[model samples]
Target: MKTILVIGTYDTKDDELHYICQRIADMGGQVLSMDVSVLGDPSAPTDLSKHQVAEAGGASIRQAIDAGDENAAMQIMARGAAALTAQLYADGKIDGMLALGGTMGTDLALDCAQALPLGVPKYVVSTVSFSPLIPADRLAPDIQMILWAGGLYGLNSVCKSSLSQAAGAVLGAAMAVEAPVSTRPVIGMTSLGSSCLKYMKHLRDPLQERGFEVAVFHATGMGGMAFESLAQQGYFAAVMDFALPELGNLMVGSVVHSGPERLTRAGAAGTPQIVAPGCADLVDYAGWQDIPAAYTDRPFHAHNRLIKSAALSGDERRALVRDIVARLERANAPVHVLMPKGGVEEWDREGGEAHDPQALAAMADEMEKTVKAPLGLTMLDAHINDAAFADAALAVLDGWIADGTVKLG
Candidate 1:
């Protein structure tokens, strides 16, 4: 039977917390409770007591009580709870985790959830499920957050429905979840969809045939976040970072962008990387929102109902070259950069809607000026979608594999 670790401030929400534990038990799933309460006692004992949690965080429960500020004391408890939760998962004592909370509980729950690795099932039943108060970086890439409606006061029927569903979801996830495969060396690649970026089509097969697993991530906001997280963990043997508008989006303050650590992680982890500016010419904006005044006069491409793009100016494209090159320069591993001289994205070709030859020329000129040795730079006389660009990227990968830069299985 799967075991779900239940976490909460058992002092006030004991009734609701116990109800979830009961549902899990009824479903033939075991429950291990951890109470993170600061003052009052839980209705019954917890598998991990408040005292244990406080002590694990490098303080005693008496010290937490003596500190006497709610937020400050809770921060201490959050630290302890996260440490213990990580230890529980590491010790193989918990299969999945479920937490119930309002703002304070949700804050601690996020810390606990992040303590576990990427694949672990982490569900948070909270008052603020998807609130803007919760930053994107605090969340585990795989966390499931459900609104804990009618769950604050007591165990009502509406609250019971949410609790039961969460219990079932966590248990089911634990039983059915498949860990990431590791039969061959994994290649982490980034790309936009085939329409905008076409190099992945030619590259995926040849890399796989070389006994490498090519895992391509879409370079949208959350997709890039996941890619960066995996790369930080040193999850890939090598990375082919082709499509790169997410970096540009982040630089331009677009919500459709990923977090700050996108391009730097693979190299920091010492993984060999063949980087390219596949979609660096455009900045993605949320299509549903009003177009920002700054980009109103620029060329636009409505990729879909959810996302749109605005072409950067010639000067902006030149600035992007410096940013991309600077990021590559900081990588701690083997790094080679590919610059497609003709154009980066599909819409930037001669007759395409967002085409601007001068902007492309400015970008190429800046790359030529800044990209230097120790970090390899290859300038190709082809569009990013052309066979020459793909062939050049594969050749770099083949050369890396032939050498000891990329370790194979």
Candidate 2:
């Protein structure tokens, strides 16, 4: 039977949490109810009591309550909640976790859920589920079941039925799933259609040969964000960031810029990272006609009938180097910036329409000046797609991961 862990301030919402627990039991799942109440007695018989929670948190229940501050109380409760869930997990008593809450209850339950590994089903039924959540308790990483419960104190029959079904849903999902395959550490890579196909094809075979999986992202705005978000989520062991055309798009006011959080995750999450200036030679624009008339005088490349590229100017190159350097500094993981001297893109090589020796040199000089200490910079004589370049990129990542060069933040 699947084990269901239900957490709440049983001193207050005991009836609702217990009702959900009962439905889980009715579905043939074992229930382990935990009470995180600060004051008052628990409304139902619980597997873990608030007093026990306090003790587990290294404080006495009355002592914690006497502190009387909400934030401190929440911290005590979160500590207790994590300890309780961890004990249950160690004793093989938790298969899935669900929490019912408003604000305080959600805060306590989320602490426990966040402590668990990714992919475990953690559901929250809350009043504040629809409310704008502050950054302190953001639930972006964990999956949340938003039940538009507009300020109701007690569950109506409708609430009971919906919550019961939710219990069954989480329970069934927990028990009936086949475990995911234990694949080698996979790296998520970002690239654009113009360069991604050849770039990934060149990188994947060798990386896979070395027992690493390479997941590629098409550098659409969403694709790049999703790639980095997964890194922040701890889904990838390393990142082979090749395409930063999204930066150009942002600078030139195009539609393909990934959000401001792009390169920050690798630093924050401490994932091993290697970034390249691939496809940074130009900003991508839609249709030939859509190319701004102002850009008509600049060097341009027609990658296809639909796509046109504009070579970044000297001033733009300086700004981009600053942007890239700032991103590298924010990276908590060991970072290496690989500059392809021969070319930054497929069309940036000698005889290529967008090739500009002066522009490339300025970019390199800016990066050399901007990146200092522990963070390293590599200048490559070959293009980004070259076998030598890919090999060097992989070597930097492998070396850092093997040597513990990147400190986990």
Candidate 3:
């Protein structure tokens, strides 16, 4: 039977926790309840009490209860829960995990969820699943969350339905997930839909033929974050970072900023990386989101109901190029910057709405002037999506692989 860890501040969420525990049991799963409450006694029976959890975080239970500071107490419990959760997973006692909470509970649960490695099932039922209050950098790359609607304080019909779904989801994941088998070294690539699909198509087969697995990440804000996180974790043998719209988003103070350290991780990890200024010409926002006042007059394109993009001005493009140069300067590994002179995106070609050769030229000029070794800079006559650009990028990566600068499995 799958052992799913149930986490919560049982002092306040006892009934909800008990209901989910029973639901998981009904589904033929075992429960390992961990109580994280700091103040009052737990209403439900717990296998691991708050006292143990508090001590795990380096504090005594009595000290936590007497502190009378909710924030401080929650932070303490969160640290303890994270350490205990990792230990449980390491011991093969936790197959999956589910937690329910408002703010404090969600905070502690997120800590525990992040402590578990990727591919382990992690779910959080929270009233504030994707709220702005939760810092994006603190979230695990693959955490799944259900917005707990009308499921606070006690077990109502709505609460039961949500809880049952959480139980089923976690249990099903635990039963179905198989251990990952070792494979050829993975080459991490980033791109966007339609805008840079041609480059990805050209690179994938060639990289595979050269004995490396290609893993592509879409360059939405979160996609960039995940790619950076995985790179920092040493998950990729090399990286072909083609899409950079997230940087443009960050440049203009858009809501879609990938964390502050987006482009620097692969270099910090000493992973060979071939960087391209693909899709750096635009910033993306939700289709329903209003254009920021500063960018109101910029050229705009609505790709679909879910995505809208705006072209960057010459000044904005220069700022982005400088940012790229600054990041490349810090590389501890082999880095190459490929400049596509024709255009950077599908809409950036001649006769297109985003066409601006002068702006593209400015970016290339800035890179030439500012970027230095251990960064190599190359300017190509082809568009970013063209076969020529893909061939150039692959050749650079192939050279590194052949010279033992990048080792393949």
The candidate that wins on lDDT is 1
Give the root-mean-square deviation of each candidate in angstroms: 2.0, 7.5, 1.8
The residue-by-residue lDDT of candidate 1 on 1-409, one tens digit each, is 8899999999999999998999899989999999999999998899999999999888988898888788888898999999999999999999889999999999999999988887799999998997767765677778998898888788899988888899889988989988776899999999989999998888888888889998888888777877887888899999989888988888888887677777988989988889888889899887778888998888889998989999998899888889888888888988888999999999999889889888889988898898898888998999989989989988998898788788777
Angstrom error of the Cα, residue 111, model 1: value is: 2.3
Candidate 1 collision pairs: none
Residue 81 Cα positional deviation in candidate 3, in Å, after optimal superposition: 1.4
Looking at model 2, the pairs that clash are 267-331, 267-332
Q: By TM-score, who's the top model here?
A: 3
Cα-based lDDT for every prediction: 0.89, 0.75, 0.86
lDDT winner between candidates 1 and 2: 1
**Model 3 vs. true fold: TM:** 0.95
Candidate achieving higher TM-score, 2 or 3 = 3
Model 3: per-residue Cα lDDT over 161-196, one tens digit each: 888899999999999987544489999999999644
Q: Which stretches of candidate 1 lie over 4 Å from their true place?
A: 62-70
Off by over 4 Å in 3: 62-68, 195-197
lDDT of candidate 2 at residue 247, scale 0 to 100: 77
